[model samples]
Target: MAIWYTADTHFGHENIIPFSGRPFRSASHMDSALIENMWKVVKPEDTLWIVGDFAFGPAAKDMNWLEMIFGQLPGAEKHLVVGNHDGELSQLLPWDSVSQLTEVEDNGKCNVLCHYPMITWSGARKGALQIFGHVHNNWFGSRNAVNAGVDVWDYMPVTLADIERRARKLPINKHWTDVEQRTAAE
Candidate 1:
């Protein structure tokens, strides 16, 4: 099965938060749109790596909602790399949750998975690449990193090409510009 990665779904984030400008008139509408888009690209045998922010609140309150939406997606299995936004996922959801940064060694290359970006100097010691989410933008260093954020569109899953282009440019000295943050929020 092919493995796909994505992050920052923000399912219940309907109204635009002050920090993130995601807009939705209602929670149900946002959830429906997100689910519909996710299923369009995902196949029954495909595996999805949801990096983080699976749900908005307490597990009990959000479990039913998440189950309903996730159940409709066509995927053989789903792996989660927990993010700051996800709360009590193990207690709320049946799926396994990983608390630490995950690493994969493939074809003489190493892949590191985490919710946050590492310091610029950290990339110098890496192997193949490091893929993560959380910063939205303003990634550091030139080792290899990907942003699986909400801005990624449906049907078009994040591709290796996209990741490569962004990853090649690293050691960003400045913080994520306000414009970039606004774009992500939108």
Candidate 2:
């Protein structure tokens, strides 16, 4: 089964549309599109990891509404790296796992997952990749730290290969040199 990752969905937050410059006309429209986009690539057998900010606004506070949205998530196993917006109700969803930070081994490579991007992470000096969200469209992330937010990734979950490919083309993080050994290229 493949592993998929995404973050900062802000599913029910109406204000996010205007604030983040999202293309949706309304929150409902954005939610539907996000779900559709996820199902397009994330199959039932794949594992889906949402780094943070699963939902927000009035809808998120309702147990039934949260359940409805949680039920619609397309994945055999869902994991949540709890974000600031992920309230107690969001955490109550039957997730496979939930935490503020965790390490995942995808394609034999270690990936440090968190709600917010970090200047340094576990295994940073050993080639581990850090995937995070929360900044939304303001940043696209650096070489070693990649943004997995939907706003930057066409509002869809991405695979590890996708993240790695993007990391290679992006500029290296300035703080990378401070935490890790300097490479000849840098």
Candidate 3:
């Protein structure tokens, strides 16, 4: 099955519209768009990984609302990386897996998933790519680490290939040299 990654949906948070300069008229409008966009790319046989901030606001506290959102997710298996906004109830949504930080192997590479972007992650020197959210649209992210947040993307889940392509175009992290030891291959 194909794997997809996304984060910072902020599904029920109304303030996100203005805060993130989202074009949605309302929370309902934003939510619908998010779901529709996800369905367009994610499929029943694929895996969906929400790196962080699945939902927020009062609606997120409602189990029925959360269940409805969870039920509508398009994927045979779903995983959560657990953001700051993900409460205990959000964590109880029957995800295939949930963690504060975890490593996933995709396309013969290890992807380090977390809610907050890190200056460095496990296997940073070994070529592991770090995927994260939480910062919203503040930055586009560095080469080895990328933001999978919906705010960075066009409000949809993205595949590893999409991430890799973007990573290639983006500049290397300024801290790259500071964290990763250089080899004298040059």
Candidate 4:
């Protein structure tokens, strides 16, 4: 079984438009494509790590729909690290429905898992790496971390090998370049 990490599916976000230029007119269109693509690469025994933003808005009535969609996914286990759009999900979701966020140290590597990216670079200094989602376009560098976001949602998912080699080099400092600061200020 392989371990996969992906985030920002935004399953029910009818407003979502892929950055890659693909067109999705409704949430159903996005949902079907996401699930089909995910299952195409996911084995029944594989584990999926969903970083955050599983849902679109702040309504608890949609829990049934959420569960139905997630239940249909093919995986041995699914873990969710809460994101900003988690909303009332934390309470309505069953205990077994989602995995709690925590720091993990495995195979001589340290990593922090969270929905929001932390500002500190403690993970790298401690010989750990942080895997996160949030900034969709910040997928560059070697040691820094950011989620691939739904805009670039790839059903194939990301492997640890890819994360280590690519995301590790991202800038760890909070000070953004003039371009970055301007984008954030917008």
Number of the candidate with higher TM-score, 1 or 3: 3
Candidate 2 at 153: error in angstroms? 0.3
> Which residue pairs overlap in candidate 3's backbone?
none
Q: Can you write out model 1's per-residue Cα lDDT over 52-134, one digit (the tens) per residue?
A: 77666433256676777567655787767888877764325655445547764434555676777654323333434666777
lDDT (CA) per prediction: 0.58, 0.95, 0.92, 0.63
Worst 10 residues of 2 by lDDT: 174-183
Alpha-carbon shift of residue 139 in model 4 (angstroms): 5.6
What order do candidates take by TM-score, descending? 2, 3, 4, 1
Q: Which stretches of candidate 1 lie over 4 Å from their true place?
A: 15-18, 58-60, 90-92, 105-108, 120-127, 137-143, 152-156, 169-186
Writing each residue's lDDT as its tens digit, candidate 2 over 118-160 gives 9999888778999999999999999889999999999999999
Residues 1-186 of candidate 3 have per-residue lDDT tens digits of 899999999988999999999989999899999999999999899999999999999999998899999888899999999999998888999999999999999999988999998989988877788999999999879988999999989898999999999999989998877867677983
Give the TM-score comparing model 1 with the true structure, all chains together.
Answer: 0.71
How much lDDT does candidate 2 score?
A: 0.95
**Pairs clashing within candidate 4:** 133-147, 141-169, 141-170, 142-168, 142-169, 142-170, 143-168, 143-169, 144-168, 144-170
Candidate 4: lDDT of 85?
67
Top of the candidates by lDDT: 2
User: Which residue pairs clash within candidate 2?
Assistant: none
Task: Return the candidate ranking by lDDT, descending.
Answer: 2, 3, 4, 1
